[model samples]
Target: MEPQSSLPDDLLRAAPKVLLHDHLDGGLRPATIVELAAEIGHPLPETDADALATWFAEAADSGSLERYLETFAHTVGVMQTASAVTRVARECVEDLAADGVVYAEIRYAPELHVESGLELEDVVAAVQQGFEEGMAAAGGRIVVRHLLTAMRQAANAREIADLAIAWRDRGVVGFDIAGPEAGYPPTRFLDAFEYLQRENFHFTIHAGEGFGLPSIWEAVQWCGADRLGHGVRIVDDIKVDEAGVAQLGRLASYVRDKRIPLEMCPSSNIQTGAAPSISEHPIKLLASLRFRVTVNTDNRLMSRTSLSKEFALLSEAFGYGWAEMEWLTVNAMKSAFIPYDERFRLITQTIKPWYAERMSG
Candidate 1:
């Protein structure tokens, strides 16, 4: 018999979720994209909102991370002006809040939004403004923060790292390196990582998704990432025997022993060919092994998913119950880049209480 959760969709939507790996540029509403693109006269593959949504999903499902990223051109293209960027950011928060996300750290590359004469600082400010508006509009239902990202292939990692630190007190909570992981290793940004370390700031690296064990190894061992973005490939180091006994390689063991968080995005991983499907995704095995595993929706528009939807899919694929859902959510809350007291408060006051109620009832 397959294990399953009695939790229904409505209950799952009501469950408080904490997201750590979402991309701001990847979560804009289809209608918003249509209007923004029209204002800038940017050509889209599809004009109709529904058709554009389908196009994004189809384009991202290409199985090559490089090709999947090509879809961002439309999103990044439309988000040139400050107003456009702010609108996208605000809508991102609203959507996540409606999906029952209690806390989120939305990451985006400021460098990508400066095409139309806006400075990098302007981009960050616009996103911050949007986040504030969305939070107030949600009536304190959600708390959102920024994670400024530097493209791994870019040479300005140090600048972006500084930008993250500069806004740390405002709304930005952390920093990250994203983009293709094949040729652009995390070590390339050693200076920025070193700077963050010196400042005692938090950062995550995109690893073990498009690439393999070597990428994850560098992000963890060399770059000292606080968390691994899409670290599904860590399973490469584990050997499972015929009798179901599992052997952990040194790197894998180190990650687990150290309690390094894995920001595993199952649907996004499948679209990028990191894992063949949700059932075969390494998140299941990693979670079972007691690795600090957390679920995320890397891209809401492209993957057509939300935090709740991601958990629902996981529950369906892995036969996870409310207990498992609570575990994954608490793991994300613990792994968040916020301060210990704040994380502890949310885990205790908000997240756990809801789960306790559902489980007990």
Candidate 2:
């Protein structure tokens, strides 16, 4: 961990942040995973909590997306039971709230948790129950919304889309398709995207993280995604000169012109080898060009980071300060998958006012 001098604990501890991307199955507590695995007779990489945490972090940082995703099997294995799902979801809420997140949108595939004969709705209900419990027990106010993800490798996109629409007014805020991005293009889920579009439901697509500009192009042009999840490789579409002049390719120009929100998970991007390192992260390039870039923790447990840790990394890498952090926070708020009225209310009533007070002090 970097020193807190650049991003003081005072600022990080109190920063009212908005999180756009996170995974439910990817953020379990190591000790909780161990106990849950024990109850279900599921073997774990390590019996000790600290060692297990280290194991997960190391496995995810191996520079191979397939290897990084292997660590999730243990977490998802223990999440098949309803009680386990509820417990993890509630704890996830408490953890985010404690980390000073005022609002968050967490996504996970429900089909991955139905192994023990639980129906799809049962899976969603269990997670919703946990979110309710966590919010009630939160040390402060925290609002959480669920985003249902359909695995690209699986043939359940239509079902997941219907599930998202079913839970729209209940708790599900948006829909997403996550998994291998190379061969399985967003066009494979045409029916699902069409259904969501007809219903006017919000959705985001995982794009341009492991893949390149073509994947991002398909995600926007073909899929009509409301946001681009980890659209780091959109940088591949940018051409820069020795004089620091930048030229945007057609795809990059379209993304910027359309103002599609880019869900940039900086640390996770580096760990996944999406960017060479933090200094060359597309976030700096995209932010400088005024793309609708929002910062996030893609998977807190796997990445072993929080919103604060993400900011701390950005601060050290880019020399960020209060103003930069504030702009990023507001960018996230603007690019959120919520209704305009609610987004404005959060900005004016929650985010802006809180930060304004901090600045005045």
Candidate 3:
């Protein structure tokens, strides 16, 4: 941690953040996209930086996941070569460190980056190289890990899962299945999940965002997801009263009982229409109910946000003071895919002391 900053907002920004649900392709620099697209002879709808940024935000605000995902065509288009991948991954870390993310697991589908004839291993290697460079560039102030993702809409999950295991010590921290979750249930990739289970690998599934409680249930019960991605739809299984009492369905009770982490992205949930607004977000209910909830930025480019921005929005909606913020950050670190000792070191050596000072200030 750095020296204590005087500004309240600065303190919030300086606080240690652990992010488990950020997307690599979904958070590219707009200017980098323009340049990379130009070099690759790919045409974007708007080449101008400002217009391109607006295009992503506006396209993603469609209140529909499928429509919102269409905007990724431009981002993924330019990110084919090794150089592009490394640069994007490097800049992602720098940006996250600037936003006060002390640790982050950025997931990306290697298959998506293979359009340029690069093998899956090649893509993973490039990303690992980039993450290492970024970590060193940050002077070891941040730890950037990669989560190799397999698109649920595709059929290469087993391959990616194997790759994740093979590269686990080589910088890949975990595995994930990402894509539209409606028709493509977690059970569709049961073989991969089962393999991961047998191998003692960690994985998270994209569920209960564009889908509902059923998706989350399958991810947890059937696929055995270590964490849930954008699980805002878990609210569907929870009934609340005017008196603030919540009646949890059997599945909800099990999720809470198991202490499963919900990687909730408030802004992206609203953009994807999973939630009506931040103020009305179920995070407040879940947090109050003591669910293992952690805040995150699902996509920085589309949402035009960072970790601090998400914290600020949540603070406004839930009146979260430093204590609440610290608890949520600790929740994320505790739920991280890293080893137990490393996570503890981060919490005790960095997170706890920083928040203690800020809270008592």
Q: Rate the local accuracy (lDDT) of all candidates.
A: 0.93, 0.90, 0.92
lDDT of 1 by residue, 1-361 (tens): 7555566999989999999999998999999999998887999999999999999999999999999999999999999999999999899989988989999999999999998899999999999999999999999999899999999888999999999999999999999999999999999999999999999999999999999999999999999999999899999999999998889999999999999999999999999999999889988889989999999999999999988889888888888888999999999999999999999999999999999999898
The TM-score, computed over Cα atoms with residue i paired to residue i, of candidate 3 is 0.97
TM-scores for every predicted model: 0.99, 0.97, 0.97
* lDDT of prediction 2: 0.90
Model 3 lDDT per residue over 1-361, tens place: 4223233688777888999999999999999999999998999989999999999999999999999899899999998999999999999999998888999999999999888899999999999888888989999889988898999889999999999999998888899999998889999999999999999999999999999989999999999999999788888889988897899999989999999999999999999999999888999999999999999999999999888988888877667878888999999999999999999999999999999997686
Highest-scoring model, lDDT: 1
Q: Which structure among the candidates has the greatest TM-score?
A: 1
Candidate 2: segments with Cα more than 4 A from true spot: 1-5
Candidate 1 positional error at 168, Å: 1.0
Q: Which scores better on lDDT, 1 or 3?
A: 1
Candidate with more favorable, higher lDDT: 1 or 2:
1
For candidate 3, give the lDDT of residue 127: 90
Better of 1 and 2 by TM-score: 1
Give me the runs in candidate 3 sitting further than 4 Å from their true place: 1-7
Ranking by lDDT: 1, 3, 2
